[model samples]
Target: MTNKKIAVVISSIFIFIMVISCSTSNDNPSETPVIPAVLNTVGLIRNDAGALNDGYVLFAPIGSNTTYLIDKCGKQVKTWASSYKPGQSCYLLSDGSLLRPGNTNNTTFNAGGKGGIIEKIDWNGNVTWSYTISDALQCQHHDVKALPNGNILVIAWESKTNTEAIAQGRNPNLVPTTVWSEQIIEIKPTGTSGGTIVWEWHLWDHLVQDFDASKANFNTVASSSKLININYNASATNQDWIHLNSIDYNASLDQILVSSHSFNEVWIIDHSTTTAQAKSHAGGNSGNGGDLLYRWGNSLAYNTGTTTQLFGQHNAYWIESGFPFENQIMIFNNGNGRTGGNYSTIEIIKPPVSGYNYTQTLPYLPATTSWNYNYGNPNSLYAQNISGAQQLSNGNVLFCNGPAGIFTEINSSGTTVWQYINPVSTSGVLKQGVTAAQNSVFRSTFYPKTYSGFTGHTLISGSTIEDVNLISTSCK
Candidate 1:
């Protein structure tokens, strides 16, 4: 009851309360830091549990001439320098070389995804071999695939004059001044900088159009689904008609898959055909020569379906053997004009194959996607163009929201486990806390540590591409 006794009791209660409060704060820290209204941090953003850590990501910034290989922690492992910026895909080859398309700035075939040269550079930055496909009449662009036999498959724009287009049954009213048709050329590398075109397939050769009955290639549009309808998306001013943005080769079946951006379709053609046979409707293993053996996405392109499944999509390719969903195609559905509202999704479809040929169906088989991923909030993943997705060995999906220069990896359950933002912009490396801009990446590819390309090379990890500060110390 004394004054001293009362003071001691009050002091003990105060100390006990303070101790409990400190313990609670220390035990239950915030699960995730509050993100800024505008994200300014670059490089590795997240590397949560469940991410495939035994891999490196390879990416070519659209604004830079350098291709980078970085670890999951955002440490640079290696880089390949080029004289020209990416035209815009790059790949690390099994023999410790970089294969990339360079934007030689071809004025004649000036369009998106324009690449006039393909270069193979050794790990030590030596240009081992280079091939030029740029010219007035035709120019290589977009993607290329290295064949198992040391050859290359290239996608190019083959120009056709208005007269030439109309002669092939293109509607006169829709014919452009110059129609940039597409072609796939298989190049046999003879020596450094020298390549022989051993085989080529032209889109012009397998055309069918209902616009002009008098034309030699005229046929019912829906019935001749095997052939490209020359008038489907023809425009009076848009010369880049069949804008094929990606090319993938399936070695087992000897077929090539190409994504037609303008048509909103993914098509497969027989690669086993000879040049002569490819120019006709008969001769390849499928007995259809270079005619499209399988086509999907927008069945409306062939007048077979009412709903269009893909909108301005990109990076359509077959899931490689030995990986989950092998042989199925995975696409970055860009969702440019998606009906419900623009949103992006990584989609996979199992094409019904019957020994090198797709099942004969009105709108192609596998009517819906077997698997697809979008952020719980779909809009969070939207990218209007130039994005890509791939299934990693651990069943995680790696993708790039190209326009945002953001790369994300999600596990099989659609949970984000890893993420990174490209730090190099058109002006070079950005500083942390500086809003990332002009740093778009066409795509980012995941190469497992066991990749043959990393063999015999010492991969020394270096600092992140961007300048870091205290705010990003946790990432370090």
Candidate 2:
């Protein structure tokens, strides 16, 4: 053969081999995508407004196994390493321990926010206590609250069969083979990995379905929001009926506030009730047992009216005492499914609780919000899901735009005093607008400068602020 012909043949062979190798690599399901470290932050320190409360923010990226504690200047002061990725939430306790919900290999329900394991890790990243509360029937998910009595409050799904749901007036077509309703269980740790289910409240226990009058719990839900409408979310076959995302306890009021994403409402239930009383309609401080003593945000959830109060809200909790708002409620209104498109708002409202039931005549509280913060720009402040709002001791509000990975602190007058864009990106290739979708954080919480969690630890900032690439993003 001629030398030129031989050289051409060799080149063809090499190109063929390269194509085959590339194709094989692309077909491998085990190949992990290289996550990029993209820092997008203005880190603008605007203490001039006096809204800047010197504190540390803690959060874990949705799929990342490591949780971070960063200072106001956007520096990683501390971190906790975990073997399993945090399913959704992580909280730093006052005694230097971290209470975190994590995902397990178990695939019982395979639903969103299915966190099977709750672990208590110390300051040095050692697992001090761990509990597994998931099984084929039910599993913990989303948010967990640390109670005052050392017991932990967890949110789980109570699985119901199609027949069971139909019996409760659920439309058969909407009821898949299995349906999941929200439940709250207060667990008292008896051992390292096991706990006693000290107190429990199930959404299934308090339901009213006008769909089938023949079924049990059938009622014409008039003014009472206590009975959940089983057919309210029957558009699709998805069984996550009431996707309860957050749970907050008011120790003074002895009530538990839960935020339901699917229902677009926040319900206040009496925490002072016994387990048996909670399952019944009468027997608590408010004489409403496990039933919702007060509900707001979405009035249509009850038969009251069709006024859209809160459009898929989150992090509904009571403000601490001594603050200006004091006993008012603070919430992150994830303004999804709104008339004007996607926009978010931070709102504070005063609930009129004469006793167990809400005394307000209006469908929802506050003919107008007592105070609120919206960027004025429709798309300025929006997170479709997994965001939160916290009221700081200094009367400032810390808002977490979870999907956007942006955390901001704003003054009472709605002035942004500080801002930080999370630098971590799930996709190695950081596209400007889609970074939020790729890399999301469930929530970010602020701890005061004097938080006891930092007592014994030597804190140092291991993070550097990098200029963020601004993205023109729109919300659905």
Candidate 3:
């Protein structure tokens, strides 16, 4: 009832409330900062018992003008120079010639993944042949593969008009500019800088649409759901619907395996058909012509949405026929938006084939992957884009976690035997002390020491990244 008594009581209540608030804050202290996955060094991290494939690693940076062939120790054995920035893919031929895609200035098609040129240079760094594929209608982009008969298989974007896409049942409001579908073209190089189209396959011809009954490809997805949906990237008009990233040829089966990154599937098409026959569904050795002989990964794209298989995967290909895990399909399963979190996985599946078509149930399909590599910790090992995996001869797998700039090899039992961080850094990737982002490689492929591609060329000894000495003649 006194003034002093009232003031003391108010002071006590204020102090008690402040103390409880501070305790609650302490109890929920900010979570520990999670370390990101990045690599800043080059050379061996752990060469447990040595490398499985004793040879060279060939890779080109995403924004560079040079491609290097380096030994297992990361020593550059050879180099190929070009006038254009490197594309996402490159390769070396058995005759010591290099095949690579290069970027060119573009003003026509406003899209991503722009590589307008492809060049072939000999081991001596001479431009043997070059060809330009970028145009108003389409442009070469991500990947390329050299065929056995001296032709190159290139992936490009074929433009679709706004009116045309809307006619195909795409939402007009969702279309910003125009739609770009994917295409595969086989080009035979001619004099110096020209090529002739020997064979081609377009995705536009093999699409399925159910949104419009009056459209050319109209059909209920539930009735006949084999073609790709025409309305995938419904938001951005400049977006690519079917971004095809990697391409591989199966010589024994005369088929082609292509990775459609945007759609999350790998398509196998017969390469044994004539150019005219490839436009239809009835002519190749498999009797399917340009139609997909086999398709696997995401069924939701085809309307069989029971279970999702791949999450924006990349680089799906068949293992080399004679390798230890030969004939099995492999993928750089960039497990984005997965149940747990973002982590990359290597999925190898022996497709159940009964003749030409894939053999599997409608909803459950294939049932399981033959083998895979997700290394318990998926978050730290995730690379959402631009990566690959290869099954080696000694039953080991070599893969590039592109985003982290790390290349690793693991045995059949999921044990890491060899590891290397890319030491070479691109223009903006150089950090003060961190080695996690020194450099990034889209893919790194291994070559045997005795591979005929290196037969006569003398490999030099120097730093992991060195200048080439092309004084000697090439293997050819």
Candidate 4:
């Protein structure tokens, strides 16, 4: 689908997609989509990329529980809606399947949160394999990456001996009320007994300071004998409060790169290529520390925070297998509310040499730092300052003005070549003259070098796609 055609389809959906009426608010079903999946597009399109020749876009639309798969031109292709609230790490496999982490909370999860499930979805949206951590302690905030040998690597939060710690009287000093262990595990599909764990890592054995105590959000840490930390506890574990949101393994470097969103840094686990996970097994004891190595995002000799490392972003890691910069780290800098520097941006940076390296020679899509926002009053559903950015093969950028549900395509020089808007609303909330309409985007993501599909058929392909082919036999 061409950008123009995609725009028309989005407009049509907006024109017919009914808005909920307030008169029926009381009678409205309790299950209105909390993550409504309406979508749109933005930015200049691309064509052939050096290494990233073709790929799809993956995103969590508002309302829907599934992870959507759209074609190169913004055409709805497939979906993996396995959980109510899908986690941040979802990788599209080479076979067109998807790998994602999910969880279920004992108490009520937020309106859109639910059970946890590590899943492998086939192209037909079928669950080829699934593992649900027992109901006692739920695993949230996880990341997954597929290895060359078909094994999957994961970074997750595991229920620690905290309850056991309190029972044993060995709780660390100044620990938050909520405590849990952050972990990394590798799963290999064994034709018969599901996937087997090949390697694993944890956050406990490596901490030397009161890191979790600094994270002070989310009750993942604890000071009481309570089985778990208060849901209000700021940091969960890792005194640094390392909220590991995304993980990527570089086979070339035999290294594991983790995006610790909350802690404001990335962690690298370096293992020599000569011994790339040679003798590793998952689900091992946390006391052993030889099987792993570590480096801080900005403190190491090679990482100098050159491009201003991300602050609270989601899914920052290597591109897909066939992507142009397959090994480079591309981040969806969600710009989740606060950035000491620029308001929001999507950054694609080359991996650092060792640690403590820095550079600004990367491509950046900057959000409109200042944009007025007034719902209804002539500007209802008005654009806000929040924005999204993705890197294309040819160095152009795909930018999403998240606040107003607006998306635009830009060239390498920062030009809007294409655009889109999301119009998702609640079931019974009418918007006559309000100041914050219910239709917009929480976030967006594009496939490496490929035009990640958008809602309906609003595509943001590269400038190479001069015109979108909406009526092509491609959809048939």
Q: Global lDDT of each model?
A: 0.87, 0.77, 0.74, 0.45
Q: What tens digits encode model 4's per-residue C-alpha lDDT throughout 242-267?
A: 45666777776566777666554555
Residue 317, candidate 4: Cα error in Å is 1.5
List model 2 lDDT by residue over 152-185, tens digit each: 9999988888898899998777778888888899
Instruction: Point out the higher-scoring one by lDDT: 1 or 2.
Output: 1
User: Which runs of model 1 end up more than 4 angstroms from their true locations?
Assistant: 1-40, 375-379, 469-476
Which prediction has the highest TM-score against the true structure?
1
Please report how far candidate 1 places residue 394 from its true position, in Å.
Answer: 1.0
TM-score of each: 0.91, 0.84, 0.85, 0.57
The best candidate in terms of lDDT: 1
Worst 10 residues of 4 by lDDT: 367-376
- All candidates: CA RMSD (Å): 5.9, 12.0, 12.9, 13.4
Flag the better candidate by TM-score, 3 or 4.
3
- lDDT tens readout by residue for model 3, 1-476: 79999999999999776544432312322322111122213444445553564688888876567887866544567878898877778887899888888888666754545789999899999998988887888889878999889899999988888887888777667775778878889998899998899899888777767777778788766444446677654565456778888899988887889988777788888888897778887887877767777678877777776666787888898888788668989999888766567778898888777666665366425668888887455436788788899888888989998877678888887777777666556663233234445377788888888888887988774544522211111110
Clashing pairs in 3: 38-436, 39-435, 39-436, 40-435, 40-436, 176-237
Off by over 4 Å in 4: 1-55, 71-73, 80-83, 106-115, 138-140, 161-173, 190-193, 210-240, 271-309, 319-326, 334-342, 351-390, 399-408, 422-476
Better of 2 and 3 by lDDT: 2
Give the true-structure RMSD of model 1: 5.9
Candidate 1, 63-122: lDDT as tens digits = 999999998877788989999999889999999999999999999998889999999999
